[model samples]
Target: MRIVRSARAHIARYGEAPSFRELAAAVGLSSIATVSYHLRRLRELGVIVETRGRVSARCPHCGLTP
Candidate 1:
């Protein structure tokens, strides 16, 4: 919950979604495994969604340009 919320907050401020690496770095989490677990949670919760690959792209279904 904390990771997802932190990530969402970061995105809300940055205007673009952060990659798992960026989000993890911002929140001080030390492992990609941990971030991956949390990211799955966020995806399942519908608070975030993954899409076609890019370093900092928002979902086509949601975001400023969508």
Candidate 2:
């Protein structure tokens, strides 16, 4: 999933999670709703998590927080 990969990379490079708009741009997505849809699915699958409006990979080995 590009969104997940991009989110992890963005956090690794910037030391913070990206906003939905930033993520949309990073993954070449034109709609924030699409990002939201994918995020929801990812969350349900335990591939990602959201805390206080920030999104991060669920795997601890990813070494990121949001």
Candidate 3:
């Protein structure tokens, strides 16, 4: 949930998706791998979509950008 919230806020603030490092920092996570894990979960949950090396939020959902 923290990952999701951070991702959403990051997108809202920057108008773009964040990198793994950025998201990790925002969420107080130490591992990019951990962030990646949450990201995969988000994808499975249909919260975010990754395309062409960039990440974007699904409509009506909070998400992080690449």
Candidate 4:
């Protein structure tokens, strides 16, 4: 959940998604692969979605891309 939260915050603050390295650093993760794994799981859980090669968290209430 931290990664998703971080990603949403980063998008809000910067108007763009964070890269894997940036997301890892933001979440105190040292491995990009670990971030990748979590993101993959989030995608499967429908907590996040990938569009046009970009990943973003979905609005929990409406399930819309944020």
Index of the highest-lDDT prediction: 2
Please write out the lDDT profile of model 4 over residues 1-66, one tens digit for every residue: 798889888888888777888889999999988998999999998788767656676757544455
- Top candidate, metric TM-score: 2
> What TM-score does prediction 4 earn?
0.82
Please give the distance, in angstroms, between residue 26's alpha carbon in candidate 3 and its true position after superposition: 0.5
Query: The CA-based lDDT of model 2 is what?
Result: 0.84
Candidate 1, poorest ten consecutive residues by summed lDDT: 53-62
lDDT of 1 by residue, 10-60 (tens): 667876667777877877988978888867775676655666531232334
Residue clash pairs of candidate 3: 17-65, 17-66, 18-65
lDDT (Cα, tens digit) per residue for candidate 2, span 1-66: 899899888888988888888899999999999999999998998889887677776656666565
For every candidate, C-alpha RMSD to the true structure in Å:
4.4, 1.9, 3.1, 2.0
Ranking by TM-score: 2, 4, 3, 1
Residue 53 miss distance in model 3 (angstroms): 4.0
lDDT by residue for model 3 over 1-66, one digit each (tens)? Answer: 776677667778888777878888888889988887878887898887766554565645423344
TM-score per candidate: 0.61, 0.84, 0.74, 0.82
Residue 12 shift from truth in candidate 1, angstroms: 2.1
**What local lDDT does model 2 show for residue 2?**
92
Q: Which of 2 and 3 is ahead in lDDT?
A: 2
